[model samples]
Target: MISASAAVLRAGDRPYAIEEVILDEPGADQIVVQVAATGFCHSDAVARAPKFVQVWPLITGHEAAGVVERVGSEVSGIEVGDHVVLTFAYCGTCSQCADNHPAYCETFVQRNILGLLATGGARATAAGDESVGARWFGQSTFATRTVVDARSAVVVDRDLPLDVLAPLGCGIITGAGTVLNVLDVRPGTSVAIFGVGSVGLAALLAAKAAGAESIIAVDLHPARLELATELGATATILGGDNDSVAEQIRKLTNQGTHYSIDTTGVPEVILCALGSMRARGVCASVGIQTGDVVLDGHALSGKQLVSVIEGDADPRTLIPHLIQLWRDGRFPFDRMLERFPFTAINEAEKASLEGRAVKPVLVMS
Candidate 1:
């Protein structure tokens, strides 16, 4: 058994307890990663909600950056000492994955959300030999080390800052991928992003990198709006005036934006996003829904409302593209990052929820 120090979530209403746990041996197609850093994401927050959690003692950090410490016997194309970013798991043989759309893998829910292990046993155990759920997004990275499926690891250059690149796995990829792959945002196009959090801001950066003529950002926080404006949002809206929000977007872009992205997951905000799109424009919904989206019969007349998972990205390709963009100084995603020690996981989570931090990265001690 491998020993690891992890932040364990035992219940929805409780704080994460940092404890030493025993990790199972890597499966034939899995690898052991020594986590350097991990990002705090909204999905982790959702997993903490009692209604969404199907199991207790779950470890749910998904955006992880690490160095491979061990490779399973059957693992290929990756080796120990390689720098890697851990992403959501997918069955490589699935139709969606075969088509290079791993985000829509048929077993996504079972593998990513359920933390299912093909080895037919728990991935880790806490004190007293109690089982712990740790395969979250194929890598329960709220720890110093983790076991992950080989297919979910994307190897990157060793010289890159692991702490800053940690979020590329999920939040960053989700936003950028939706714009570049799903919407095919072109030069001189217009886009409006709802919610200027880490994900939304990532979209803003990608839109700017794509040479979008007009980039609008909407959020409830003035600080975030200010940051968005600094980071290249052509305009920023305070986001409470639902009726006027769409009208304002239309007036700015001559006839609404060509594309829009919703990362707020609030039903009203989603409607506002749809309303801010021009006729036949596409709006990608990537947020975790808090309430049901009740749409009017004519709400989607010529506009398209799409439910996207992880920006329809194949991490192998998109991650490298993003890295290149970053190297070119066209995508400055690091402007939104804030770091905290791994021992301060609770503090980092609180800062994320309170909007004090945009992308909080937990660095291993």
Candidate 2:
């Protein structure tokens, strides 16, 4: 096993501690990636909370971009020195994967969420040989290094900056995928995006690219709303600016938006997003919910709510598309980024948790 400095999560509601850990070599079909950069996403943050299985001593950053340091004997089409982005783990042999929906791969929860690596053992350990949970979402990129199944990585052009493209694995893809890949959005369609965070803003950008006619951005943070407006939102609404956010949205769109998306998992906000859509309109939620979302029986007459993961995208295809979009100056998601040294992980996490930053990318020193 090789040594690397890693952020160890030992408790819920506690800060990450930098500690030296033992990292194992890649088994066949897996590769050792010297992580170049990684993004902080809400899904990674949720592992710290107690609701889920509190697998302590876990290494927990998933949005990874790195270079291949070692290639597995069984892996192909990838080689050393390739720049890659780590995506959600999927047992590629599963039916869902065969259907081209790796996001919903049958083993998604077992592989990605459960922290189960290909070898069914810890890839990292503590000083005295204590098992440390590794492979969180197939990479656990919180450290300076990681080992991942070959299928979880997508090689990108070397010229692309890893800092900004890192988030495409999850956040950016979720938003854009839901818009361009999942929903029936088209040119001149009225759409509204709620929350205006990474996911929401990504949706805004995608909607603009899709030629959405009226894209309304809703959020409590005026700054995020303004940023959304600058990105592509035709209008912005302050969270407290109206008695009813749905009413404001409906009134603004004449009847209501033809479609809407909620990146804020707040149940109330989710309901509002559902309410803000026109008849037969669809609403998608990318946020982690705090509680149940109950809909009005009448509102359910034609409106539909869909829960999506990883934007329902096949990473291999979607990530490359995003790269092309970025190259064409269509998707400028980099404007929402801020960089931090890998050593300042705790401070970075704080900035992200408290809403002080939109997309905090940690650079490996």
Best by lDDT: 1
Model 2: per-residue lDDT, tens digit, 1-365? 66778998888788898899988777788888888899999888889767574456799999989999888889999999999999888988889999999999888887888776455335688889888888788878999888888998999989988988888888999999999888858998999898988999888899988899999999888889879988989989887533388898999998899889988888888788888889989999888888987776675668889998889999999999988988999999998888999999999889988888999999987
Clashes (backbone N, CA, C under 3 Å), per candidate, total 0, 0
lDDT of 1 by residue, 207-239 (tens): 999899999999999999999999999999998
Highest TM-score scorer: 1
Model 2 scores what on Cα lDDT? 0.87
TM-score of each: 0.98, 0.97
Score candidate 1 by TM-score against the native: 0.98
Superposed by TM-score, candidate 2 places the C-alpha of residue 251 at a distance from the truth, in angstroms, of 1.4
Q: How accurate is candidate 1 locally (lDDT)?
A: 0.91
The RMSD of every model to the true structure, in order and in angstroms, is: 1.1, 1.4
> How far off is model 2, as Cα RMSD?
1.4
